[model samples]
Target chain A: MQVEFWFEFASTYSYPAAMRIQSLAAARGVTVAWRSFLLGPIFQQQGWNDSPFNVFPVKGRYMWRDMERICEGLDLSLRRPTRFPRNGLLAARVVCSHADEPWIPDFVRGVYSANFAEDAEISDPAVISRCLETVGQDAAAILAAAQMPASKQKLKAQTAEAMERGIFGAPSFLVGSELFWGNDRLEQALDWAARAAR
Target chain B: MQVEFWFEFASTYSYPAAMRIQSLAAARGVTVAWRSFLLGPIFQQQGWNDSPFNVFPVKGRYMWRDMERICEGLDLSLRRPTRFPRNGLLAARVVCSHADEPWIPDFVRGVYSANFAEDAEISDPAVISRCLETVGQDAAAILAAAQMPASKQKLKAQTAEAMERGIFGAPSFLVGSELFWGNDRLEQALDWAARAAR
Candidate 1:
């Protein structure tokens, strides 16, 4: 079955899922597609101007601790990013520009690690440029192209596509027509994908 | 350290938490006070007339599978109950009436098992009566008391108290003045309780 992982670079739980999804999907003999999309538009459509974590302090504190525990259990690196909900506009644009490239998954994972594991402010052009360079892509050209009109339009189109799919959060998975939300639902999504393929 | 477990008998996730809380608390040398409360009023205050699980099918399905996995991982028995969001009024009253009783925790756990492990409809007086009888309590007298006008009022008052404490879900725990909602927050609540007690 073909499974598409829809993720946002700024999402906390998406970090672990992005880090392990490739190997896990491969082990299950499933084909995976990586999708980088911004959750800002989806949150606005849901009548929210910000992440729910920023809206609820108690739940937010619990989320941070829970993420720590989950990351430790998964043996993944985690650093609470100083700049949360960083503007992933440039990152999203770059991913959209290379939407058809096989290395898009690697780029998405690199961006996630930059924001979540390295505590870098992903809204900074330098940070995103560094991430692209780490993945062996030409940082300057990718950054320049990402800001091009066509690339910006493509990013907006992808966000609109996610909204049409009823996506309201990061780390969502789409298998055929079914949408599974959250990192917690990754296993079920994978199972559904595997069954669909069979 | 002292910990108070605020749970509802009809709560899906509370069954496993109730089954393990005592042992886990004991191992940590912490005392646990089991307080049974109804979730109906909380749901109402949250502007919902039913269990969130029943209101959202996708989340409900995910919860069932997640509970199954968590129970299996813990070597605990879990049977999905037929009648969900059961009228926990009577059961809550009984716990309130026996609030000072030390054996109330065991009785609460028994009720949880009857609902979640035995797949029993806990709203039925007969089921609750059977549960009470197993704990060597006067089923008829307790059932009669649980149905009293005063008992019903007490249940309402306790639910109001839960809302005031910022509780929005079942199987919550109170560590000092902090309220932690859901069974998944059990360990973190205990840890907080331990630190607070010190």
Candidate 2:
């Protein structure tokens, strides 16, 4: 099945998913198309200017605990990032530049780890540069390319596309035309992908 | 710490929680006050008119698998009931009538087992009668009383109260005025309860 993993670099849950999607999809004999987009515009469209976690405390607390349990079960390391939802503009731009390469998965995972595992301030240029260096890419050139007007326009267009596709959150898996939201939907998304492959 | 366990007899996830809440809470030096309520009205108010598990196929499939994983991990038995959501009306009423009894936990467990473990149609009067009998209750009288006008009104009022309290789903736990929804939120709820007690 042809599956597209639409993710935002700043989302907490998306870190675990972005780290695993490549291996999980490969095991099912399915190919994944990585799509990097921003959720800020989507949240704005919903009449909210921030993540729901910031809006609701009790639910937010539960979400953190739930993520802890899930990450432990999956044997993934997790550290509460100092700055949640750090700006993904540079990260998104790098992914967009390599939209046609198989290296997109590695790039996504690198960004997620840098933000979530290292607790780096992803909005800062130094943090993003470090992420690029870890992924064996030229940080200086990548940063320059990421700042180009064309790259900024591309990121905006992708966000607009996501909104039009009825995607309201990150870690959304698109199988053919079906959109499955949330990390909890990961297994079901795989099932749909397998069935589609058949 | 004193905790209120708001449960619906027909809820799939509530079975394991109902069976374990008392023991788990007691082990933690906490007391649980069992509160029986119906989820039908809540579903109706949300424009679902049915459980989200039944309304959304993809979500429903994931829930069944997720429930199995959770129950297995918790060392609990789970079977897909013959009826999706048995009319929990009679069961809720019986529970309400015995709300003052300390044996209410056992009754809730029995009802959950009958519906989720035995694949019984909980909405059916016969199934409920058998469940009550197993719990040593006067099935005939209790069943009759469960359907009485007063019992029916109590059920309606309880559901209304849940809505007034901003409860959108089950199994919800309230510590002070804070509402924590879903079984996944159990740990956070307990933590909040502990802190509140302190």
Candidate 3:
């Protein structure tokens, strides 16, 4: 069985999920379809223009603390980003346009590392290009392709699909119709996929 | 080490948590101090008159579904409350006034079962009295005690303490200064307490 892992680059929990899902899914023989989608539209529809964490300060405080514990447990590095949610539009567009590419996973991890660990501005083309280059992908051509009208439309459609599927947050895993949200639910999702196969 | 389990009777997730936490904590040699509090003030501080789940329909829908899976895994029966977030003020007053009573745990579980499992109106005195009676306590006497000014003041103070401690929601756990929110974090909170003792 397979699981569709939907993530947004700006999501804090997605960083750990992205870094771990590949190996975890492989161990359970669950193929993962990495689906990069934006939470912008979803939040906007719910009357929020920013991340819910920022919209709710207490939650924002708890989230950072929770992320610190999660990162420590996962042996991942974390730094509070200078910008709460540096625009992930360009990075999302790039990943959405190259979803099926062989270098997508490494590129995904690199973007996550840049945003969370290094606090680099993910919206900056330079940061995204560095992530692409690190994965041995042709950065210049890919960046140009990501800006194409078709690529933009793909991301838009993907986001719409996510909303229609009732995704209210990032790092959601869809095992057929069973939707599991958050990084915490990753193991359960993988187990669900493996069990469904049996 | 000890963990303070702060919960509200109207909170949906608190049902499973109340049912399971005592056993789990006991198994880990962790002492649990049940702290009943209200979410009304906390939600008001965040500019909401209703539960965040209800204010955001998408999240509410997801929450119910998620609860189903969690309850199934825990071997607990759950039925959606007919009224969302039935007033837990009276229940909180009772629990808060008698925080250290030997029967407080059972009383907490009884109230949760009434709201979630039986779909009873938790605000109804008859319902609460029945819960108290089931726990082998004098229903009328305890109910009368719950209405005393002293009882009311105790609940108010407890709720204030929860807010000052950065509790934004119900079913939160505090191990000294470390705050863990949600039923999912119960295990981690217990682990933290257990480790600290060693």
Best by DockQ: 3
Worst 10 residues of 1 chain A by lDDT: A52-61
Output the TM-score of candidate 1.
0.71
lDDT of each: 0.79, 0.78, 0.93
The candidate with the higher DockQ, 2 or 3, is 3
* Model 3: per-residue Cα lDDT over A1-198, one tens digit each: 999999999999899999999999999999989899999889898789999899998889999999999999989999999998878999899888888888899999999999999999999999999999899988999999999999999999999999888898989999988899999899999999999999
CA deviation > 4 Å runs, candidate 1: A1-6, A15-50, A54-90, A93-127, A134-136, A143-198, B191-198
Model 1, B95-191: lDDT tens per residue? 9878778767778887888777888877788988888888888899988987889887887787777767766677888877666667767887787
Per-candidate TM vs. native?
0.71, 0.63, 0.98
Poorest stretch of ten by lDDT in candidate 3 chain B: B89-98
- The DockQ of each candidate is 0.16, 0.10, 0.74
**Residue pairs in clash, model 2:** none
Give the Å shift of residue B110 in candidate 2: 1.2
Instruction: Rate residue A99 of model 1 by lDDT.
Output: 70
Please state the i-RMS of candidate 1: 4.7
TM-score of chain A of 2: 0.95
True contacts kept of 1: 0.00
Tens digits of lDDT, candidate 2, B1-198 = 777788998788787778777776766777777778888877775456788778755456656766886788788888887678777778888887788786677778888888888887777888888877777778899888887899988877887887777666678887766776777667667767777787
